[model samples]
Target chain A: MSERLEEICSIELPTGESVGVHRRRFTGGLGPHVAIVAGIRGDTPEGTRVAHAVARHLSTHHERLCGTVDVYPCVNPLAAHHGARHWPGFDLDLNRRFPGRADGHAPDRVARTLLDATRAADMVIELRGAHPAFREETQAHVRHDQPVALERALRANVRVVWRRSAELQGTGTLAAELPGLICLEGGVGNRLTDGVGLELCDGVLNLLVVAGVLPEDALPFHWAAIQRPLVATDEDIVRVRATRGGLFLPSGRMWGEVEVGTPLGEVVDPIAGETLEMITAPVAGRVLAMREQPVVYPGSLVARLVAT
Target chain B: MSVVFRLEAPYRGEYALHRLTFGGNGPAAVAMVAGLHGNEVNGIQALNLVAGMLRVMRPKRPVHLLPCVNSIGADEARKRWPFDDRDINAAFPGDPEGAPVERIAAAVMDATDAELCIDVHSGATTVREHPHARVPLSGPELEHARAMMLPVVWRRRGDRYEGGLVGAWRGAGREALQVRGGRGLALDMDDATTLARGLVRLLAHLGLISHQDTGTPSHDTDHVQDYRSMAGGFFVPEVQTGERVVSGKLLGLVRNPLGGEPIEEIRAHKAGMVLAVRVYPMVHAQELVVRIAEDAT
Candidate 1:
């Protein structure tokens, strides 16, 4: 077994310079192939971190692997370069350009190249970060209809496994192109959180093992350390919104259990100390995501709760 | 102008949704909205023009005109909210306690509670569109659009009414339609004037304004064909908006940006009136170059 690095595509910049999308491949005893993709949007640095973490572990244990593992870290290098959510010049979300045009712009071309390269893989895992506006709990999202993906996602070692509806999936997304795809994400966007990187890193490695890309004995940590996640459907989730426009001060911790009518947050005047409204849970549940950015208007989502 | 909704802008002063009222004896009989997309200036100007007419010729029925909903976005010449980059139109049936844009949307929804509602807008910044009314294939809204007598009356399917203020209004059981013209970030005087006249004609048709002459719609199309560039380059339109064309007519050409070579020549497929033409020259592959409203048989 050995490791090899390859350039999937190079995006030509306006100034004649170019940025390369690189793939780190680990090939061992032939079995099933798995690809871990990250950084379709520049803001999701957490995904990039987990990708590198998985790569670091596989680098040392590639010799004892059962199959091949391809880690594509920071596919949108140009966007990642400026920490933008979309390609700077075109203002296009790379994730929304999947199954892209062969003769399109650099972003579309890169999307096409990455899609074409990973289409043949047995398992596809997309690593992402929480929306920039919130701090989310560690979770794995699998299309509700994909039982095989849902069954495999259970071993991702996350706090929750969400079975999302197929309609909720945006068109041209990599997951939409590849059925049975598993998406793992959590933590604050752009900025990495404590323990989140390591948790997600372990999650990816466990997924690779589940896909037979790597041997279980090669795991850096014991398998028993992974926490079994609560499986939830769309109906099990509750969204709590702010009723007043002001600053949102969250009272609850991420992934903490709460009863109905429990205080979730408070919206207060930015200038004065007067509280505008107290947002409370409408149902007994656990906080899956909490708004991090404070400024709010009426109907702004303050927190998302997963029903108990 | 009355402040229907107000919210504090983070560092900036504050955001206000203003509505100009006329012939206010009772509930609003007609509601007209513009500036939902901040960069679409033609709608804003057209609504203002209607407001000017209402100032002199007092309407028989109550009318509500929201001339500039996204004032901040208009100030910055942005299509979406400047602060969060959210499309105000997309936040329809808005939450009163939601985000600033959503709150604004909710406020606009509440403010425009009328018997007949119209959401006015302009085409994308990259394209120029002739003054037109887009409504459901067969409904009261389509009749209202016919009364408006815009240059092009596009009868589309209900499925196309998925989001935005018009959809939101329709979802809430209101008869709603959309009026589009000109180009975003730029105001075409003729298109704006046409939109303004159409609104006046609609008021007349509703018996709110006296003795208004309704002009006929130049083109009524249910079959609009969109033409796209096969290659990425500088798009040069051979025809202008509102120009009548035959099948295989030269609609546009995509030329190599570097060497000035013709990469691909785009031609019309059906004999119709050119409803839209690309204004911005630089285009990507598969980008819309021209749209023609096909002649009715």
Candidate 2:
């Protein structure tokens, strides 16, 4: 097995500064090809960490690799450069420009190039970033219609495998363009969370094993050590929103169990120092995500629960 | 001027959407909105100019002017709402009981009820736009836009107005158009005056005001072509917006900033008026450098 670093494309800025989006390719004996992409958003550093962690492991076990595995540590280098959600000057969200125009602007061209590069892979896994306002449990998301993707995500070492509605993915998203794509996201946006990188890294290795890119015996840990994730459909997940506008104090623990009416959080007036409303769980489930940014408007999402 | 709507903001005093009214109240001759985007100062300026003109004159019918909708954003030099960073324009036909932006959008919708509605805007901070009216290819809107006699009358497809305030008004069975000029975050007096003149012309055309028509006729066309840089480089434009150019005119040059090497030369394709020009030099690949409103002939 041999590994080669390849540049997908180089983008020249107005200052004649050139930056390249790169991928590390590990090629072994011919078999199924798997691609791991991360950092579509600059704020999602957790995904970037997980992408590199998996690449480091792949480098050590290249001899045992059965096929080719491509790891794109960070796709949007420009956004990542500024730690911003959107491209700096354009203020355009890169994730929303997928299957983009080849002859169009930088973001569109890069989107088109990335989409074309990964479309033919046997398995494509996207490492997504958490919304900056929320701290999420390690989770896997796939389209509800994609049973194969749903089944594959079960071993992703996540707390929940959310099979979302078609429309929920939104148009112009990476998941919408790529059929049978599995998206993994965790931690807080822009900040790295402890244990998330390790867990997701292990999950990727396990996925590669499932995809025949690596042998089961080559996994650093036993296959049985992986978490048995909860497979949830769109209907099973309920979004908890604040009824009153205030600063939210999250009381729910990540992946913690809950019964109906359990206290999840409270909304407090920032100026008056008074409690406005107490948010409680409406279903018997586990806390999947919690808003960490505190500021909330009426109808603002405070948390999400995956009903058991 | 009166506060048409208000939202209780926890941190700030409160978010107020104000409206300036003119003439006796009945069905309005027209409704004009500006500063939907906080940084688009030209819109705010043009609307204020119109208000000044209307204050002394008695209109046959009522006319409404919203000078600065996103006042908080304008105060902070941000394009969106300061606290949440949400675009107010996107929340059109919005819910009164929804988010702050949504409620503000709903209020604007409720307040801007008129025979004809015009949403005014400025180009982005990085680009300067000439005063122009964007209307449908063929409608009462196109005719009204013609009456404005702005520098350019851009006829666009209906689908293009599917999102913003203009779309919301059109969806409610009202004729709507957009008037844009100058650049965001800065004021250009000439472009603002041009926009104000166009609004005054529209009022005269509607018999709401007995104003004189003195502005030049607009370059009417449906062919507004955008020229994008093939590569990222420092762009130096040679022509100012509102300037006329014949076929194959040298418009701009994309130059390497590190060394003084020229990477690409951009030129006009046909006879037209420059509708927009990139102001900020630093740009990425494929970014819009210029937009031309091609002559009808």
Candidate 3:
């Protein structure tokens, strides 16, 4: 186990000032290698923290592990320096430059390097945090056609496992490149929340156990404690948007259950303090995400509800 | 109106790049393109206004007007292609076999091959820009830019030209320049009129159009300076774009949004014409708030 664990790849930055990409490898006998990546975007600190939590548990139970687990805690270091969403100076989004050119600038070169490194892994798992404007519930996203990924996400301790169409995903992203990849995201953006990180950390560990990378007994928490996630499709998730542009004051909490016509939030005129519109739940479901940022545009998403 | 280029768009009809040509067309020269970004409607209006004037007058050489290149994005009021959010400007000298936006870029590049190319644009949605010409210091292009009779002729370092449409045109061995005015998403009739007049003056300078005294060429100093915010806060500008400022003048103030207390006072370091001003209040640390082009002595 110790011999196999020494094969992690770590690439230094071009500035010769930093380590850009760090990979931690854990291997037992070796059957199928799986990779877990987080913090492609600097604003997604929750994923980085969760990656570290999983790494800590894996280090203690290295002997019982099978195959290999490659963990990349932070991919975009320069952007992470100031907790920016995009790479500074270039102002490029690293995720949107995948399959990037080697001869290109700093961001493009980093994207190319990361893509080349992860291409050979048997299974790829990308971890991310919610958008900075909203607080999201724990969820696992898999491509609709990837039944194998769907099965794996079911065992990942999340409340709802969503199978989304590839068309709904953005181009040049990691998931777009790897169709079968399972993407796990939760918690708030830029900041880490208690219990959310630990739960997602456990979910990744449980998936590792299910993939035969780690033994069932090696897990710190009992398998019964993991939530049996409900499977949902893209159509089952409903987005609630504010009809008017104003200060949105949310009443519904994250992951709170609600029925149709329930008051979710209100858009009040900032200057006059008059209620412009009342945002209500459109379907009987649980709140997937709620806008944390008060200021919003006319079509700005205020909340998302997942139908049971 | 002639169809200069045609591009196929997904989930929508084909996009046509129309050209309004004027005069008897002796030596073909000077092509102007605007609205590559759909939200930049000021340039589109300016080009259309120029086209309307050119239709009545006859000139020696040909002038091609590409009023709106990103027609589909203009329909949705988006800066980039809505099908896949892509900036057509970034896809310069583009690929024919690429995506929808890239194909459009390629078509425009192929269609607008002329002696001189002017890529017209409005400022970003968050900022308002004065009518100005951006050119390199000490060159024939700089002299040509000066003849435009715009409010500001900013002679910048050539190294600043990279990855943009003008840069790509220069790389392809064509003389290219950029003219900017007004703000994005909104049309300023006065700014658009100024830009249209500047284009006419540029055409007259090129011997393509005949005009009686297109204002004495502002033999302005080629010097320009940028004003950047020192801290992240809500920026409140005291001066508007195109306003002449003296040294030691208050350009704007950066105030903390939470407490409404002034964090930093941005003062003009040099006496110049305010070429640009940040319209959006919320600013990040070190972002460009104003750009001042020093007036000729």
Candidate 4:
């Protein structure tokens, strides 16, 4: 079976130029339709990389695929072109313009088109990267009420499966629109990390296997290679914030175990190099994320730990 | 001028919140603040003008003036904090130990201990708004806005003040209102003067200062209609801010970016004063081009 590549949305620039957002579709002996979307925010290149990797694997095993799989590699192409978090000229976050207006601006039109195109899919998987300020460990997030999504996310081969509450999900996000949407996020924003891409690509493939979009025999890696993730609730996550405006020097590693009061980082005066504040763990847990950039204002999130 | 709050900025000098007080401390205290959005120069100028007036007038009760809260942002002509791009106004009832903006917000909230508080602002960069007061449909704030007697009095719903400094002040059970004029990143001396006069009128209404003529009464209304561009183009506005127009009046024309003919001509749907007009020519689809506070039929 051959693959089909189609233009999902076209964005018009002020200079009379147009950029096309495309989707790659692979159909075998139709079992279930799954949509894998990425690059809603241009800064999240990790998602785009994983999307292409999954697309490449699907292309190679198109003949043995059990169902239809649609890969939206990059939705906000103009923003992706310049590596910006928002649409270049408008400064609008495409992710926030969901279930958008048909007759609205270019960003809103693209959002509406993408939401319309993926509404029919049985499963929708959104890929994202960590915030630009931090480096996060591999994780899958599902709405707390969605048991099927939670169950599917557990098989995504991530280190943590977070069942987040509706209040914490934020407004206008893709997951807010699609209740059962599974979100996979990790690594650094804008820049792809070593092994992170491969790990996420493998995870997407594994999810495809579980969804019956591809046969288990078609997976590139052994099933045993998948990590059994620690399921966590919203309360299990502890956000560690800086108390002083300074440079945050991280002392803890991502996913590293720590006891209560463990020194997570030390905020130092950038000029004098004097220790302004020593950040410590509040609970015995594993560090899920660590701030990479040094500069921090008071109350800046320096690190996040998942309580065991 | 006395420093009410201070915070150590990382690489720069310390951030200080300066308060200019007039009259001795008393039971009747009124606080007025501006420049929460650094780019909004009109409010800053208005407060400064008010400050100039207050320097000579002997007030019966205490009056506090916070002219420019976001001095750092004002220096760079940016609306948000230069470091984090966070809106200081949004961090209201803020964290004293939070970010720089949050600390400033908290300091502002703490400093504003008064019977009535006023937060002043300006229109967005792309548009120029007539000097006006935005208040609730029926409340003390509306009466206070009428006392200011600016060109326009926009009586809106209570829920509209659910966020920002005005909301935070209201949440604290204080009589708070918002006043705005001109445009951000630019100065309109006339509009600033109008705003200053209106503020003084409010002081006179409160019996803090001797009564003086401010200006003509504002066009009071509760119906504000917004006209948005249907397509991305160069919007050429036909009407200016504060101009009155009837329905079917040509408000603006959206011309194609290229040398083509006008793509769309937007017309007024209601008879009212033009509260706002898009000054910037380049516009995106659904961007506000004009706003009219429709007169009740």
Candidate with best DockQ: 2
Clashes of 1: 6
Per-residue lDDT over A1-308 for candidate 3, one digit per residue giving the tens place of the 0 to 100 score? 85233323233232223343677877777677888998889999999998889988888888887888888888887678899877765557888988776655556667777788778887889999998888988999999999999999998899889999997776679898888889999888898978889989999999998887888988898999999887889999998877565678999978888999999999887777798899999999999999897775445678989987
Please state the error at residue B171 of candidate 3 in Å: 28
State interface RMSD in Å for all models.
4.4, 2.2, 16.9, 2.5
Q: What's the true lDDT of residue B149 in model 2?
A: 91
Better of 2 and 3 by TM-score: 2
Each model's TM-score, in the order given?
0.86, 0.93, 0.58, 0.92
Better of 2 and 3 by lDDT: 2
- lDDT tens digits by residue: candidate 2, A195-261: 9888888999999999988999989999999999998888999889887777899999989999999
lDDT digits (tens) for residues A207-258 of candidate 1: 8888877778889889898889999999998888876667899999888889
For candidate 4, give the docking quality class from DockQ: acceptable
Predict model 1's lDDT versus the native: 0.88
User: What are the fnat scores of the candidates, in the order listed?
Assistant: 0.23, 0.62, 0.00, 0.30
Scored by Cα lDDT, where does model 2 land? 0.90
Residue A197 in model 3: shift from native, Å?
Answer: 0.3
For model 4, residues A257-305, the per-residue Cα lDDT tens digits are: 9999999999999999999999999999999999998888777788989
Q: What's the CA error at residue B236 for candidate 1, in Å?
A: 3.5
For residue A87, what is the lDDT in candidate 1?
81
Pull out the clashing pairs in model 3. Answer: none
For every candidate, C-alpha RMSD to the true structure in Å: 3.7, 2.4, 13.2, 2.5
Superposed model 4: Cα runs more than 4 Å off: B26-28, B97-100
